[model samples]
Target: MKHQTERQAWMEILAKSSVVNIERQVQTLGKLPEYSFLRSPEIGLTMLRGRAGGTGEVFNLGEMTITRCVVKILDTIGFGYVGGRSKRHAELAAVCDGLLQQNEWSFTVQNQVIQPLQTIIQQKQEQQQRQTEATKVEFFTMLRGE
Candidate 1:
């Protein structure tokens, strides 16, 4: 259960990270351990949904392109599902995912790859929010008519 939670957290990070960033992080691990693909990376579509007004009603938003794969490293199996058409990114993410499940590599991956990617994501989001906030418009009720 504990491992599941940690896996979910890292998966979320991997899902959001760019292809280049994820690929780069995986490369930093030097020579990767032996892994066999249980499911080769493949492209697919996922149905997206959204709420009417944040919480009012749910509706089909659209379909999104995604690539996913399953891989085995020793006894552990790792899954990777990421957006877009980057097959290599999906493969690398799966490899990293398998490594992360092992206690021997979990600490290193969490500290090096997952956490750093998360920080990069957070900074990008914050910068976007600031840019959006800067464009806010204000209106006054009483003007020339008064």
Candidate 2:
């Protein structure tokens, strides 16, 4: 599902200000019956490629390790995954997902958490792109006469 404007605003506030404590927001949100079973993963899967040692074409090797988590509120579930090899994140996600499916946690989950996290991830990507563009450098070599 798409994120709401309020979620986007919150994410922007988070991105722009270090003074805004995320944990506080999380805690506040956590108290809501809608966000009781949310989980954030620590790692995820990345595509791996195989290439020759010196100079050769690259080939798709296989899927690399990953981690993921899920947050559930009522009928809504938010799944988060990161690229890397880590079992902890995957386990956390699984547990959240399981909790979401259980009868006890089905009615307390909130959908708001997904939007903020999604916004933060997008913002982080944009920041990385901006930083990369800002730091782009080029060098030219001078030719010498023998």
Candidate 3:
């Protein structure tokens, strides 16, 4: 397996992050540079696939709604694809993606935006895990008349 690049990791984090959290963190950036929409936010549907039992044959489960956008900041282009039909979320994600590619803003965005978003995701996952663990059932076998 190949390791993901830093950009890939951050992009994944952005995609998984909630729009509310993203907007909150991005607000701290103060001012943002001007950008043009290469592809304005558009809503569409993508085929969702699934396996029978995690290892079985793949099949089309259904279609899921998605929003995608593309933005150009200076010479760099950013792309965002997110679940549901939130155009604002898609635009913000694209802006973050473009900013992350710039050397001047990369470090600041990494520290302020990416890290916090990743932490939030981890915390949520941990909380969900704890909740699930609480409902786990244990099975035991006992000898009867041996």
Candidate 4:
């Protein structure tokens, strides 16, 4: 597997993170640094696109509720876009993103937040794959002797 850049990894973590999980983790980080919201957390709708049966025609699935925010920590800017309508989640994600950009907190945040979240996400995916594979069906046919 190709090595993932720091920014890319954090982006994934922020996107996939659970609202409660993120809230809890961020709470443990103690007081936040001085920062301002470039954009306050706001809920919006985004078009969801889907491919039929994973190989068929593409179609509009539906509209999904999304919350987004942007924050600036010192000279660095960070953004968060999360699925669902939780404003708090978006805010925390934005804050965490900004913290992750800072050199002083990057390694600590990576080990405490991003790394553990990645592990949890990986485990969930593996469990899902196992469950799906367990339900697989195989068909076979045997020739009859004439």
Candidate 5:
């Protein structure tokens, strides 16, 4: 159970790390087979330039490039590189790329990996909601030094 807790914690971290909308990501992920595994989408930051008042002024805003890999963990058949261009990103894609293909990892991947990943994702969202609710503030005036 504790290992499950730890695994859930990591999944939560990975889920929160991406800028891609998590619910949409999960929904899209659910459409795939149960044993399938999707790597955490890679996201990158970019600079965009814009002008104010019809080109009277210019400014820059940061943007992100997001890439996701969807794979059948059973067949190890999946595609990588949906968004950003980073070697590390590509390497992460590659690990998923390879594991998704191998048959030997199937059971271990499904039980130890994918199921826990989904569970943690759900747990993290609930924890976030609880934290947000806990922070709600109420104001009141108090009698002096009572």
Candidate 6:
């Protein structure tokens, strides 16, 4: 269960990160192990669903384009799914996933690649939150008696 949670966290970070950011961080890892594609990167559409008025009935929001790839490195397999049609992004994500699964490379990959990417993501979220708060409005009522 712990292992699954850790993978889930890292995978979420990978999915949220931009391809350029991920690629930049990955470049610091030096030589990468050879990997073969288990499933070639492919683009497809997934239906998006949304709720009306936050808690009302759900409705289809429309379809979004996504690209997915699977790769095998040694005995472990990795999968990557990203929004849009960037095949290279999907491939790089798969490579990172595969490396993160191996005991020998997990620590290095997590520190050098995943941690920085996660930091960048957190910073962006914080900035957005601050911006939203800045626009917050407050309302009050004044009473008049006859």
lDDT of 5 by residue, 19-79 (tens): 3333233343333343444554455555667788767688775666645545454545544
Which candidate achieves the best TM-score against the true structure?
3
What is the Cα-based lDDT of residue 60 in candidate 6?
98
Per-model clash counts, in order, read: 0, 15, 0, 0, 3, 0
Worst ten in a row by lDDT for model 3: 137-146
* Clash pairs for candidate 6: none
Order of candidates by TM-score, top first?
3, 6, 1, 4, 2, 5
The models' CA-based lDDT, in order, is 0.88, 0.49, 0.93, 0.85, 0.48, 0.92
| lDDT tens digits, residue span 13-55, model 2 | 3333222233333454354344433555555457888887736
Per-candidate Cα RMSD to the true structure, in Å, reads 2.8, 9.1, 2.1, 3.1, 12.3, 2.8
Clashing pairs in 1: none
lDDT of 3 by residue, 36-102 (tens): 9999999999999999998899999999999999999867898898998999989998999999999
Candidate 4's C-alpha runs over 4 A off are 1-5, 51-59, 142-146
Return the TM-score for candidate 3, rounded to 2 decimals: 0.91
Q: Which prediction has the highest lDDT against the true structure?
A: 3
In candidate 5, position 80 carries an lDDT of: 48
Model 6 gets an lDDT of: 0.92
In model 5, what lDDT does residue 52 have?
A: 84
| Cα error, candidate 2, residue 144 (Å) | 14
Indicate the residue-level lDDT of 25 in model 1.
78
Of models 2 and 5, which has the larger TM-score? 2
Local accuracy of candidate 4 as per-residue lDDT tens digits, 51-94: 99988999999999999999998778889888999988888788
Candidate 6 to truth, TM: 0.89
